[model samples]
Target: MTGAAIGGGLVVAWWFLPREYPNPLTPARGEHVLGAWLKIAEDGVVSVAVPQLEMGQGITTLIPQIVAEELGADWRQIAVEPAAAAPAYPNTPLAKRWISLWDPATAGLSGGVDDMLAERFATSNAFTATADGTSLAAYEQPAREAAAAARAMLAMEAADRWNASWEECEVYAGLVRLGDRRASFGELAAGAAGQSPPDPPPLRPELADETPQAGSSEADAGPAASFPRIDLPSKVDGSYRFAGDVRLPGMVFAAIRHGPNNGSELTGFNVERAQGIGGIVGAVKTKRWLAVAATTWWSAERALRAMEPQFKTQYPVSSEDIGARLDTLLTAGDSFKTHETGFGEEAMARVDMARRYEVDPFHAAPVETASAAARLSDGRLELWIATQAPEQTRAAAAKAVGLGIEDVALYPMAAGGSFDARLENDHAIEVAHIAKELGRPVHLTWSRREEMIRSRPYAPVYTLVGAQLAGEGEAEGGGAIDALKIRAATPPSTHEFGRRLFGNLTPWAAIRETTGMKDELAMEGMVPPYALPSVTVRHVPVETGYPSGRVRGNAYVAGTFAIESFVDEVAAQSGREPLSYRMSMLGSDVRLAACLQRAASLAEWDGGLDQSGQGLACLRIGDKETGGRIACVATARQGEGGLRVSRLTAAVDIGRIINLDIARQQIEGGLLFGLGIALGSPLAVRGGLPASFEYADLNLPKLGDCPEIVVDFLPRTDGTAAAGFDPGELGVGVVSPAIANALFSATGLRLRRLPLLSGGL
Candidate 1:
């Protein structure tokens, strides 16, 4: 990979190489791990091919933009593909997602998504990843920085060709143009490739610096505010190749009929019956399931349909059994108050006078989750995974297959309906292991029933909360809340909060800790946007048989409902108008004010004056500085047998509006997610398995559920660009709170539990 000394005549090569491996976790340097990649092709496309399969969430759109920013190539000409699991690629997501999962504090305070954070790490050659260099924290910046540096190198090359200073040569939309002399990136590829890769690449500017939809070409020497998302068109048109579309000469397909029970391993299989069918390649048994391989998916289906295998039941799960268990769990008293305060003798004196009520909202639905891929090769494994943790599977698969990480190439394609369940990579890792053992191109997609049966699902949550009236001027009502605490981490974060109001239910420190705990305390309580004299929140971390990981908003779902509903409880007791109560509590928070005004306008919230009903939920995502801040207002109407969300409006004070359209899209998506979960979202489970095998039982939000989504984003005038993720989704998350609040306004039900307690079926 040598480069010439000539300025404009420089040349570079992005070579595709497999990673060497001993242990798959952290490969030696110069080996691909997962997220990171280094490729030198014949063209100037110095590539950093990732092994992490993109399962939507703008993965395809975001990565290419970063590469173009780094490679200085025309964004249109850049091509990015999933790297194979190897020491070279490491099979991790930019090496940064891992780190972010490990420690979120290093992600910084602001909602900034910097691509440089990922680039600072070494090649995917290591197994033990760091948060700063290999975590999800740098997901936004590392690649962007790398792309910008490549552009700088290319600009220098072009400047040399024109016999001018590099400053005179500008990169415009993958082109080198100086006055009348201009050439596309493709034309200057050879010259740019001839130069050695530069160190310490520059990052793109903040959103305040660049216009939306403008490619890097618009930048003045430096990386632009936003790189052109080259994959946008392909993904939009459904033209991009996904893993499901992979084709090999001798590739075959397979299907499995597994017991609908977790931990139900293989018992036995009858190959004679399967062998009687035509095109029945073979039947492999594992615990309680039989995997049949055939020339086509049809043949595999027919063989399985032709014969039913017998199995010994190990805790055989039925729909009825699951429902009974869930009901029992739900009926049980919530262990204890996650955030209980004013409980001492003096405080108890006041509790005797305050009116008390219980609000137990549970968002329960059955979701069938499946992740499977077709196996085409054995020595070199290719996986199609349905997971957000793409890198984890790639590395884990390589290790599981007794192959170096590079021997496994994971190509992420389109995915089935996904949620937080996609973050765990066990589905991919399991399929990869089974496919290789067969020595055939095996397709292992789960059945609708299988998805529900063998679920690594989020446990059903139940919460109990109690509050009392304040005595005299002693922080009456929900005063300042003193401090907001949250304890949402792995076991390492248990007891992170002392016995304080804030530290009880919403333990804030645990979230920032290194422990992998997903706060059990916040199963339904989170940060409140409402201001009081003193506010505090905390959580009690608990690790159960099913470690509740990224289960639908982590703490957002439970916490929002708990916090917002509790606020309403206070409002009801005081007989104060809900809107007025919230406003008074918020005081003068700028961002909250913006969201309230917009939402109120959308719903015509006139202090309970008109025919319209108003509901609002405050979002306190990021701090003022880290950006990505937002506020949302949601208004809904209850009709016969259905709830109509007439209007939902959001005013996001995040990232200074890099692209209003994109920001709005993100918010809308989040709304659908949160609203649907609030309404009739997933299927139900009885014993530990999903009762609903398909969408029919687990209904999603229909087109009718779509309300007018009015988005208002804060421009750079407020501050520089901030984090984009929270701002995008916070609006969607809390729409339910707003709707519930509105319902309380209209019906005076004051329902507190989720799947909101209703009168009608």
Candidate 2:
């Protein structure tokens, strides 16, 4: 419960004088947590403050979508606000201990990748670290600990008043009861008002630091009793007073021109010439850029454009050029600690067959996208932006403008879609610095050209697979191909997962590498989907030049493509259908078989998989309930020009479903994101920059692009299902490979490259 609290005080900017209204990304430190406030306002009009901002992923609708299911309030009345970042970090329970782990560096506060590590907090196992305090053991530690603590405090308070042993007390819902006495929490809320919440928190015997003692209270009571669910109506109706919808009296809109490109600094500029322009309030030059302040967005833009900029690009590396450079970085670098599984060297020596595959993912038209809107009130800079990491933006802006952290207010609005791009605060920080310097609210949206020039993209990974088949099989070209090995600059990642939860990467060995099952490098075709008793997989890590951030199922996509393709080959080798081959390795998970059966029925896989060439992919995100998580099957199809996803049929058995609908939406959304990367969104390099400009040119799946999806949830019939992926963790991140493999089955063409826009489908 103890961590470094962001100190000092909030600077209240009073001047509401006309200016561009702020976007929600500019975090406003709220008094209560978003979930807390949303739950408290749950009477009739539940106002849910979403912790995650909505740039376009529809978090505004998504969070409320989940909350409305629980709150049972009218969805029409729901209102949302971007939750403030004052709780130090967003209210993620990924690693409850992430905040409580007591780091000596920041004194129990979170570290740089708090957002990444936070994923683990949602688990349920205890004992904190692995038995030896190394890896995380379980999930929902924060929720679990908080719930247990609240229960303990309630029991203790009841025990003290009833003059009875705390051991005799049991807390249910929001009530404390003993033998013949029962009291609702509302009644005790008043009496317990002044009482201090327990230090180190309360606990239950199960989450206990020590064995339970007779007649005593444990420290980990369930906080589920204290923090209630949010009930805010979603902004589905579009009536919410969003920053874009906010208008104030005498407001003046403005726009600014920073040094060419982003991160370019101004040599210097004269504002006197700008003063001559009509309605020109002022021209401010900050450390890195220049901004034009005027009465209207047009006035500022016109004046700014007219005032020819005099700056030079010091490091003129455009986005397109950066992209090509990324390839050179790959396949040639000292492997930092990416991940390692079994004995890599031993596994490599066993390889007798090898083939190289190049994945030239052209992520076109890179753009430094930002969601920011703000105004200067009195003298303070108040802003809102659509950002993945709010803290990163504030720090950057504050540092740029030389303003005290208190002066820069940020509200993390709903982000559009995070491809690790939103996490870059440079765009927002530059805008804020410009606005503050001009003494005007500046709204800066990147030009299509600029957007493509400044970005980090997924790696253009090149992988080499070496296979050593037990028996000598004639190669398609008359060469013997077996004793396999996979060496690549980029290892297969399950959704660019690098966090402690199911996202992080670990090395895999020959026994673990069934490279063909999903991605030759990632699963090393060693996925349990096959019945291979003896196999080996190895890795050779390389780096990429373009800034690579978390892309949806980053590793899963490439890895699965290689793995499942290999699986198809194995099936072809055995003269068995791919589905039959997959059915063989599924003894470990009969539920997986059930899901496969259902998906097969839905997609009619049993009828004619070979003829129709439908392929499936399933990955396991190991956990406590199901022992291991298996992304049952990501189903896909092939069409004339492009791969038409018939449906990403999924069969998952994650235990709890907080919001049945959102879970489906999240999995579906993630699935589409990965597909978008495959179909038409690979960022490319043209003359040292990304070629695709805006989404218009990028060609992501539109409303029409979405497939006919069938989500299958395996019943915990034996009370043996997982509690994570609530709604369900289908892990559709790597499902594209299955789709690709299926398409290859249908078309007989191997497109290792992404976006079949070249008319190659």
Candidate 3:
């Protein structure tokens, strides 16, 4: 891996080059690679290999948009196929090879990049990009290049046939035209088949000597723009394929019975009763798990229930116990201060006023429970799964089946929903294990209760916000914010994930422990956007028994809720309006200040306050990890039920917006997600398990409870932030803080902890 400092941050580039992988899009004619990611069929149906998983965030739609934009193909004609589980689909070449620099000024603004040629890192065929809010930022450029590569070939072929210069031909809407001559991309593709393709453009156009990259910025010019999502029609018609919808010729249903506690080893099980059960094929047993296979799913479920498996708990930890321990750590002051600046603890010591805020642990409940289908045929393994990380699924399934990566093929299925769910690949492994053992195709689906119990929930947070004001009108640096310190006691999801993924390797663990670096996912929103002179931010890592992962904004939602709410408090103390006070401290951060101002104005912040205890709040979302800007203003009222968000207005600057409909929808979806967590979705830990293990107990927000949201895009004319957008998780950061701020304005009663009113519930 190599890291390059570009723009304001480092962009990590992986050493792994894009390799040719079998194309699943057109399997009948065998796979043909066109610049790693692009594969042109003889029929002229341009198939672009997409690395990112589509979990209904419109990634699959946006990816095709970029390709169609560059390829000049009709959006309808282009097929957006899921890239197989191979080296071709990792994260992004830019992120893999470059360590993005964290810009402080923009850290508060969520600014986009400007020069694409200067920043486009490793371009490979590997569809190696994680699916998150930043999917657009991570995959857009590569998608552009892949489409352009195939288009270039078509243009070259057209130019050759017309006896004209390649530059004289233009590709548009699936046709190549030169002077009076014209040919469809399908015609050109057919002619170019079996013929030597045109040479690929240089990876970096500015430096011809540089190795050819897949998504070169220079080759990204085209006229493709927004189009209706391609996947929606099938989804609406119920023809879209999910893992649960998969069927194989000789498929057998398998049901799993995991240990009471995650990671517990299986002790023993009585399978005699289960075997005698009608339709029961057999039972596969492992030290850590057990599964029953049968001719039908109902029978498998029944047989699995009958085989009372015993599991030896490795640890006597419960959810309540973890909560109690976290409380102790919060008070102990023996935690690692992950981030510190200015006077650090000294500033907090001098504070005259302080407030403590806490957000309890929460679970993100996706409607779909885990499901997978796997088959071992002719010494080759195949799997169908709904996953956000398909490459990881492929790798895990291969590892579980004891097969080489090439022997295992993963057919990506459209997920019903994903909130950065943990065990995104766990269900695949389970299905693979059962199928390999039984020597028959196996389909496995986790029960809704199982999904709830095994959910990778958001960690509980304890935050202390302290500020010392300099006598009235004597604010520090002419800003309302004086000496400030934010101490957060958060369950370390990254630490836990690292231990789980690499704990068995002592050498890797030693290196990780010595480095003491937390994963970016864990610290998503830890950084403060404000310009506090004597600021100090500390993170105390606490362990939670269950696994945790990114669900929307992750720490950003939790941390930002505290910080933004604190900012509101400081503004109130300084005798200033929340919006004005925040803008005053923003200083030179024009982008963020602009967004806040825009959202406030659009929200009519001053027109009419919610007399029913209405409050207002703002959120800034542009950081090293997510390369975009989105400012949100939300209003809430104390209703009989709880905090009811009446309206939400967001000013977004995710550079260039792709599909306006999808972008807005993603932001809206994010707001609903944050509201769900703020209003409900609290995970109660009791007896080493989440007490709210099902929908009935989780209290998920429904459509009827959703607030009317308005999303406005900031004026943008093709710039840095335009190159990529992180709309998928954009609503997560702003919703919690905005709602919290609104709640305060309406009720004057500061409900700091998550679920807004933990006590009321």
RMSD in Å for all candidates: 9.8, 11.7, 7.4
lDDT ranking of the models: 3, 1, 2
What is the overall TM-score of model 2 with all chains considered together?
Answer: 0.67
lDDT of each: 0.50, 0.47, 0.66
Q: If both were scored by TM-score, which would come out higher, candidate 2 or candidate 3?
A: 3
* Cα lDDT of model 1 by residue, 627-741, tens digit: 3444455666778856677777665555433333344556777777777766654444444345556655545577876778776554444443443433434654576677777
Residue 406, candidate 1: C-alpha displacement in angstroms: 4.9
* Model 2 agreement with the true structure over 655-745: per-residue lDDT tens digits: 4433344445556665666667667645554433455556676787788988776665544445322233432123534565666666666
lDDT of 1 at 328: 47
Identify the leading candidate in terms of TM-score: 3
TM-score of 1: 0.74
